[model samples]
Each structure stands twice: as C-alpha cells, then as structure tokens.
Target: MSQTNIPLLSLKNISKQFFGSTVLENINFDLYPGEVHAIFGQNGAGKSTLIQIVTGDIQPSSGKIILNNEELKIHSVHKARELGISAVFQEFSLVPQLTVEENLFLGSNNTKGFFLDKKKLHQMACQTMEQLEFSIKPEEKIINLSHAEKRMVEIAKAFHTKPSIMVLDEPTASLAENETNQLFSMIEILKKEGIGVIYITHRMKEIYKISNRITILQDGHVVNTDSVSNINEQKLVELATGRNITNLFPEIKKQRGKKLLDIKNLHISNSFIEDVSINVKAGEVIGITGLAGSGKSAIGRACFGVNKIEAGTISYLDDVIFDSSKQINDISPRAMLDRGMLYLPSDRRAEGLIMEQNIRENISLPSLGLPKFSNGFIVNRKIEKDIVEKIGE
Candidate 1:
C-alpha cells in the first residue's frame, strides 16, 4: 500500500482497565504513513499506557488494533517488533556493559544458517548509524558512550530493521541543542522514507517543528486530533492540560537571597564534564541548558549527594557545609527531601514513577513519613488517595 492510501496503524475504541479502574476509555487513534504524529498530555494521562498497547508490551482490555489491515493479537513484544512496531521508551533499554553493535543486535541475531554472523551484525549496525549520520564506533562499549551517543544508538537501533513505524517516547529529553537538531534531521529522513513516526514530547517547539498532526490526551481520554497546520502550540497545550496555561514555565521575579549552595571547584570523570563552579540562591531556579552529558544532571547529582566529586567544597546556607570527603550515604535522597530539597528526575519512568506499582503506592512514596499516618510508621491509605488526587491535579 502507498503511504497515504491507508493508515499504517489504527486503534479502535481501545479501552483498558487495571483492577476495574479504567485507564483508557474508548480510545480511537491512527498513524498514517510518512507523517509525524505527536501525542501530548500531562503525566498520568494514559499516553504511556496507549504506547504500551500499540507496541504490544501490554494487551488492551477491549478493542482491536489493525496494522496494514491485519488484526493484531498483541500478546508479546517480540510479535510486535516482528509486525514492524518499535518503541524507544523513556527508560532506555541499552545495556551499558555491551558494545554498541552488541547492544544494537542484542537479540534476534540474524544468522547464516545455524551460526551467529557477528560480521554481518557489525555491518548492519554501521549501515544503520550511517543512515542516521552518526559516527559512533561499533566496538565502543555503551558505558564508554556519552549520554547523547547512547540515545543516538537507541535511535539507530530502532531503524536497524528499517521498520515501517517508529514510536519515540521523549527521545530528546536528555539531548543537547545540536544533538536534537541532528535527531530531527534523522526523523525527517525517516518520514521521507514513508515511515510513520509517533513522537511523544513535552517541548512545544518539537511539536511545531516536526509533527504533521497532533493528538491531545486529557484525564485518560482523547481530547483532540487535528492536523498540525490546523492547530497552534497554544491550543495544543490548552487541550492537553484542560486549562488555558498562560505560560508553561511560569515566570517568577528573582529575589536576591542568601546563597543556598556554593560549589568552589568540581570535576567529573569520562570527559563527560570538566571544571564547573556555580552558586545557587534560595528560591531561585537556575536553568542549565546543554547537550546530553554536559554535566547539567551531574551537577544536580553532586549537589543532591548522589555523585562523588573528585574535588569540591559545597557550602550551603552560608552555614551548613558539604565537602567531597562526605560519603554517598551521608546525603541520602530522602534526607535531601527532608531538608526541603527534592530532585525531580528526568527519567520519569525509571527514576520518577514505578510502573509495577499502582497509582497510590507511586504517589505516596516520598511522603510516607508524615505524622498523619499512625505515628508516622504506618500508611493511612485514605490520606494517600487524597494526596494522589491532589498531586495529579
């Protein structure tokens, strides 16, 4: 079939429930060939669940999936990939210990009869990387690759088989400015090749720049599906949040307060970062913009006590002090939370949210020590539900 004759993939009234709690209700969606389809929503708006169902990682409770006119019994991820559906989820699936080529062809090692063809695998990975215009060495271990390089490898792997459809979930979340441009160029190449792309991103600029159509989900339901040319970024954000958000990043007046943290000198390994110094003020949001592995997250980690700095004097509040000599356990993530300092990690799937845990458990993870719960030792499930509903708002 030609790219425009029929939708490469379609979902019809797909509804799913976990323990009788409806997660997706009457969800109807479609992805046409050679088009960049964008899905947007707030957290817990069923975007991830719908992606899982489309990728066959989980089956829908009801409704059918049609891929090229074939009804899909999406029971396993293997079957989904075989049917030309590939997803690069927010939580990267790359194995750091393995080389780039090995990670690319980790499974389903295409063989010459009965033996694994290692040479062919390397050749295939190189060809895929070339298609994406990446210059990564095939023999380099994933651990040695920069965060941006790792993300590039993930994209190259997605195109390894030259699948008809590609689903990217926040693929550029950790990327830098130049890397994002390169990735966009690659996405454009894919679209030109008549491959359907489902791009999920929180950034408004990406939607405007790449997508041909936009689909908004609000409170686990489809809110709008319209051509990108028909809707602007302001309207799309309104549809996703169910409110007229004047500014996604609310402006706040800067008040010169006491230095909350002062870092004298800092250095990191693997050439991912170099000598860096900064002092953050109380109630000030210091924006750090850089490519992947430019030490934005590393600096956050060193400040939060997760990473070990080679040399640095971290002074806090002009009184409290934290030096490089301190152990990793000294500034526990929970302790930081208790000290009115909390880290909202970038990896929402792996670091922020627990997929296996239900809504209640995930939401109540950080505030379990409140005195409202049975001497603060036991959880009051009722209070927890109220907290989730509040935060989810």
Candidate 2:
C-alpha cells in the first residue's frame, strides 16, 4: 500500500475474554481516512466488545490498537478521547436532569472558569446543533426531549470533539427516517473532512448505503471483511449469523387468537394520544409506527400503565382495566405485569436494567416478591438461580 493508503486506525489480532469465556478472538480490522467501516453481527457476536475495547471502556485480553501508525495503550475513555477518538454508543450517556448544553460539554475541557460559562456554552451548543441541522433547544432538559432528540444530542456531543476517528454504534436505532437521513448526511460531511468512521449496525440497508467496507463478526470471530460492492445483503447476513438467511423476512402468519387488549376512544391528554382505538389479539405481533412525535410510544406506555389515560376505556379480556368515565386510575405496572403484560422501554438503561447490579440481580429483581421465587419474604436461592438461568437460555 502507498503512503496515502495507510489506515488511520488498525486493530491487530484483537481478542477479549470475560472470566474464562472468549468474547472476541483475533479480530483484525482497519479504518481508513474518509471511509465508513461497518461492523455487522448478531447479538453476542462481539461487535459491542470490540467497540468497547477501542473506546477504552474495556481492555482487550490480547492484541494491539494502532492509531496513526503508533501503538496505543488505551486505559480509559478520557485517554481515548484525548487521542482524537470519540464515540456515540447505542445507549445514551446524557444525564436526564441536565440541560442539552450541560450534557454536550459534560466532561469536556470547553467548560472554563470556576463556574460554568453558561452563556458561552449555550452558544457553542446551539452552533453545534445547527451544524447537524438538529432542531432542539440547548436549554431544554434531556428528560423532556424525545428519544430521537436525545440521540441527536449524543451525536452532536461526539461531533463537537472534531475527532479523527468517529464510532457510531446503532445511531439510528431510535431515530425517525428523517433523523436518520440527517445523521447519514453528517457522516458524509465527516468523511469529506477526512475522518475515519466506524459504524456498528445490524441494518443491511445502511451498510449498503453508507459503508465503504463491511466486517462481519460471528461467535467472537471475524467471519469476513470485504468491500460493500463485493458482497450482497444475503451473503452479509449469512456471514453475521453463520447460516443461510433464505428469507429476508419471516412469513407472516394470519392466524390470531381472541382479543387480549382492546382500547376504545383512548385519549392520553399529556402525551397527545387522542381518541385512538386499537385491538390486539393474543398471538398477534402488531407494529405501531409513525413519525417521531406521532404518539406511537404513548400508546404503548398507556397500555402498560406508565402513561395515564385521560379518557376512553381499556379492556383486557372481560375486565375493564381503565375507564375515564368511571374516573378510575389506570392499572399499575405491577398489576399489568402480573397479568402477562410486559413493556420494554426504548431507553433500556433507565427503564429496564440496573447498571450497578449484576445480571442475576437485575433479572431477579422483578420476581423477588413472587411466591415461586420467594417464600413470601425470603427468596429461594436455588429457584432464583434456576429462573435466571432459564431466562438467559
């Protein structure tokens, strides 16, 4: 290769292990200037582990990370940022209580003086958001912003660093189509500025549209790495999953059981879900989709009792769970869960799991008070362990 062909960053024989189990093995990858290199894989295929190692969130068991032809011993996230590497992970890192401007410069050296220069910081944040064409107020609290807005803020924070290497892990997972397009445009701008981008996503269309090269990981190993033009979508999926994906989508079965949930003239005043009526069958897999502010999420939240219904009625089988006419409060989340209703929030870190807790503890937390896992007060260790194991399997 010529001097101009040298990779901006290269991973040489990278491998990672947790406890005694291997998570990544001898993974060799290259990210060249002005190109998008995508890492594609199924869940647990080590894509996240690889990115974490590069970002200095986790240490690799073996291998070297070379940036600008110099070997780097990345020990912490701050060190990686100092080395001109920035990343926007799948999970949002913004503090919910903080304003957009605060979150943008949270740990950055941009904040000067004993007290934060709020005026200057706000101006800088507005400029950054404008550059990305994101229409969000810098003074708005992160908790009040929509999921897509938060994702844009995360991207803005990473872009503000002006890094030579930018890593985006599933950046568009929560974004609407227009927001995704905006992000793609920003990536193009970064490429024009000679920034090497590492895009980790499972979306095949994205790889074909924006990536220069594609690297597939399977079972902790690099299955293949090739130019996007050299491989088709089916081949890429096969490589990631380690099996032939004959159908891009599974066949849609029309069979549906009795109506399990019925919402009639539902109106959630706070969320703007107005007079929406929906029926869900027992065996149906329903998809509710719309633009960013279209009240799709509110429906799910109201159904699961997270958002209160202002009017209308919600019936589950023979029972009227919620009826605004009767002025009854919505059923609690615990009551819904007991009745086999589960809600997987989009913000998994805040709503789903306890980051400080281990996997076993997080998994067993909701079931601790159940009779099967506990004897009214004391938890049966064996039962809890078995439940966790079963759920993991």
Candidate 2 C-alpha error for residue 32, in Å: 0.5
* Residue-level lDDT tens digits of model 1 in 210-263: 998888999889999988888877787788878897886686787778888777
TM-scores across all candidates? Answer: 0.82, 0.91
- Highest TM-score: give the candidate number: 2
Candidate 2, 1-393: lDDT as tens digits:
113678989999999889999999999999999989999999999989999999999999999999999998899998999898999998888999999999999976664667788889999999998877778999999999987888888888888888999999999997888888988988888888788999999789999999999999999999899999999988888888778888978888777989999989998867768889989997788898988888899899888888877899898885888888897665888888888888898879888899998889888987776888888778798888887999889
What does candidate 2 score on TM?
Answer: 0.91
lDDT agreement with native, every candidate: 0.83, 0.88
Evaluated at residue 89, the lDDT of candidate 2 is 90
